[model samples]
Each structure stands twice: as structure tokens, then as C-alpha cells.
Target: MADNAKWYVIHTYSGYENAVKAAIEKSVVNRNMSDMVLKMEIPMETVTEVTESGVMKEVERKVFPGYVLIKMILTDDTWHLIRNIRGVTGFVGEANKAIPLTEEEVAALGVEKHEIVVLYNVGDTVKITDGPLASFMGTVEEIDADKNKVRVVVSMFGRETPVELELDQVEVVQP
Candidate 1:
């Protein structure tokens, strides 16, 4: 069942995505299908807004409106339950046929679960892989797991500078 579980899109009424998600979850619980229905996710992104007063506010922006993504093992019973749930219009596929997302598509949509391995240590030499400082080698100054970011000290012209970057933007270099 675990191997078969995959993400599928369910079309819902406009502005009713969350409601449909809750209904599906309730049905899963009432029908004792926890093993089949793994998870329901509504993808969101953080949008930072700067006001005229120079204040910044972060807001959650739904990536897909009127659609909810679900991870589940597809079966007749599971499909029927999901299709009949309140606020669910239908699956995002051909008529009456549900298609699961491909592995590459899932990863591109940020729906796949990936295990991140930390390979670099503090004071280690690393090469910047992305952003404005790309291709530059820097020393890891600090690691912050809580924020999933790393601080690195890079040589900028003649000065040593500190830069904060996402964990993916750096690769450890051998001394």
C-alpha cells in the first residue's frame, strides 16, 4: 500500500478546497481507511508584502485554488469515497478515470517527501551553487537547522563577508 500511494488532484468548488479536504478526511476516518488515505495537502507559499510605510507582512498564498492534492493508494473503494465527498467536483483527469501524478511531477510540484542530509560542517570550505554569489567558494560560518539555512563567509573583493543562503545553495568542498 505504501508503495502504491501517490498524489492525485481533486477538483473542488471555487473557494471550497479546504472544505472538500476536510470532508474527505472525515470520510476516511468514518470508513476506517486510514491505511488507504495517507494524506491531504493544500500547497501554499509564503508571500512577503512590503507596505508603503516600509513594513513587511508575510501571507500564505494558496498555490492551487479550487484544487486539493491527496496522497493515497488508489482502489475502487477509495476512489468512490473521494469522488462522492462533499464539495468535490471530480478528479483532475479523463472522464471517470483517476490518474496519479508522476514522480517527477510530484517533485516539481513540491509534494514529494525528500530526506535532506547535512554534509557540510562549520568552518568547512563550500562552493556556492546558486544565487548572486554562485561559483564562489566560502567557509561555513554557522548552520541553523531551525531555519534550514547556512551562514557562510565568502571573500568579496578584498573583504570577508557573511551571507545567508538556503541549504541547497552550497556544496561542501574537500580541504
Candidate 2:
């Protein structure tokens, strides 16, 4: 609800991940608790796997086996509801307490994607604002929004050096 909801990790029995997720989703819809149980996710990744027949195939694999990520407002009712679910062993935390993930952890897990807008384009002069190369001025050479990567050519030791940086790490240098 609003900003109160936080993402929590639920541990489950191995091989029952999908079943537990489905059951919780069904319960949420039936109980009309959509407002409290905001979202559920089983983070996945696609990998190229070689089959026994020597054919390369792309397969979707769970990033975290036996674990499900849930974004919800933690309360007694919601906690009991989820804890009682068939396959859920418990929430990941200390002393049986459910600890919500921090913003950095959530971002690192790829549960949510933060949209970043870039004001500088290739050939634009910008100043690095973060990381080891902070405060260095450079010319943007390439921008990859999908990966949030930017390649900049900076003058170091009086020689041009190319460095890869995050999109948010640089700001456009004004005329």
C-alpha cells in the first residue's frame, strides 16, 4: 500500500516453488487482498544450454531456486496467510522475523527496473559524477540505455582514454 510495501524473500521446499507461488496468487485473488499482496515474482534468467543432441537451446531458469520474492505490506494477517501456504517454509530473516529487502538489494535482484533518463548524447561533453573517475570531464562516445552503460572518452595523462560508466554517473556539460 503506497510506499509501505516492501519486498521479502520466502523460502520454500525445493521443486515446490511454482506450486507455492500459484497457491499464494490464487489466495490473494480469492481473498481480494490484492491491495496488501502487491506482487509476486520468481526471478528467472535465460541461458543457452546445449542439449544432449548437440543443439543449443535457450532455456529459462530460476535465478533463485526454492525461493520466491513477494512485495507486500507485512502485517499479522498477511504474514499468517503466507506462512500457512502449503510449500512456504518461512521468510528469510533472523529470529523468524521477516526482513524486507533494501532498495539496493531489490535493484540488484532485478525484481524491478528503474528507468533512467539520459540528457547527454554521443559527442556531448559531460562530467562524471560518481565512481573512481568522479569529477572527470569527457566526451560521450556511446550510450546503451538498455544496459545503463555509457562509454566516454576522457583525457588522462594528456592522452585520450575510453572508460565505461553508468548512465547516471555522468551529467551533460552545459555550454
Candidate 3:
């Protein structure tokens, strides 16, 4: 039985995140399982390292030292393929049931790009998803696709206040 593709965390040997990801990815392709195994990532961030001599260099550092994220359709075959990877320890789930990541969790982890699909048009009502104006409902005043920004007129303190937000920061409210 196959499940919808979602992000699942996997435990790995310390410092072997990349190696395990490569092995699983290669297996997925070699087995012609592109539809099953979709994405794999070892979340990393850049940091400046300063040496004793005051030489500063930017380096990519793993955010989660011993884990990898896989976006795949969960199934018996896929599970076996992932488990058999050389450096993979196990899935980051209770017992043997793999827990898929929540959309908010994935966003917080910065593992995937958050896509905002807004059906609301200019002069339509929308909801603020993130930022200081979170949960505030407002009307769309303007949209700037080039800048990926949207200007919404939100009612505050008995007045209409215009707010600027990223395209991904607002959602269309269904009536």
C-alpha cells in the first residue's frame, strides 16, 4: 500500500547525513522509483568560522547533525530501501510507524519552500498567516509579483491600516 508523498525524518550516524541521503537517492533512481522517492535533503546553514589567526571563513554546517529529511510516498518498498542505506539508523518516528512532518514544522525547519496559493484577488478579503499581523483579516489593496509582495488594508483601532506582506504570508479566506 502506498501513501501520499510527505516529508519524513530519518536518523543517521553522526556526521553521515549526506552519505545516507546519497545512498537512498541512488537506490531510488536505480530502481526506477522516481514516483515513490521524490525528494531528500540534509538541512544545512552557513556560518562564519574564525581561526586562531583571525581568518574568517564561511562554512556550511548541518542544522540537525544526525538526521535527514525525505519527501517520498511511504510504502513497504520505499521503507526498506531507506532502512537499508549504509548510514541510516532508522526513521524518526514512534516504533515503526513513520510520522510525516506538518506543513508548519517543515516551514520552521526551512527544509522546503512554502508555497502560498491565494485564490483571493485584489479587493478580496485575506488572512495574515505569519508576521506581527498574524490572524488579522484584511482586504487586498495591491499585489506586486515582481517583489513578491502584497499590500493589504487591515482594520485596526477603528481605522483602515495598509500592511505590506510577502506573497507567501497571506491566505485567501473562503466565505
Best by lDDT: 2
Candidate 1 local lDDT, 2-88, one digit each (tens) = 788989999999899888988888899999999999999999999999999999999898899999999999999999999898888
For candidate 2, the per-residue lDDT at 83 reads: 96
Candidate 2 vs candidate 3, lDDT winner: 2
The most accurate candidate by TM-score is 2
Q: All predictions: root-mean-square deviation over Cα?
A: 7.1, 2.7, 5.6
Off by over 4 Å in 3: 1-3, 115-151, 155-158, 161-175
**What lDDT would each prediction earn against the true structure?**
0.90, 0.95, 0.89
> 1-175, model 2: which lDDT tens digit per residue?
4489999999999889999999999999998888999999999999999999999999999999999999999999889889999999999998779999999999989899999989989999999999999999999999999888999999999999999999999999999
Model 2 steric clash pairs:
none
lDDT of 1 at 123: 89
Q: 89 in model 1: Cα distance from truth in Å?
A: 0.7
Q: Model 3 over residues 1-175: C-alpha lDDT tens digits?
A: 2357899999999989888988887898899998898888888899999999999999999989999999998889999999999998899999998899998899778777645565678998999999999999999999987567899999999999999999988998988
Q: How accurate is candidate 3 locally (lDDT)?
A: 0.89
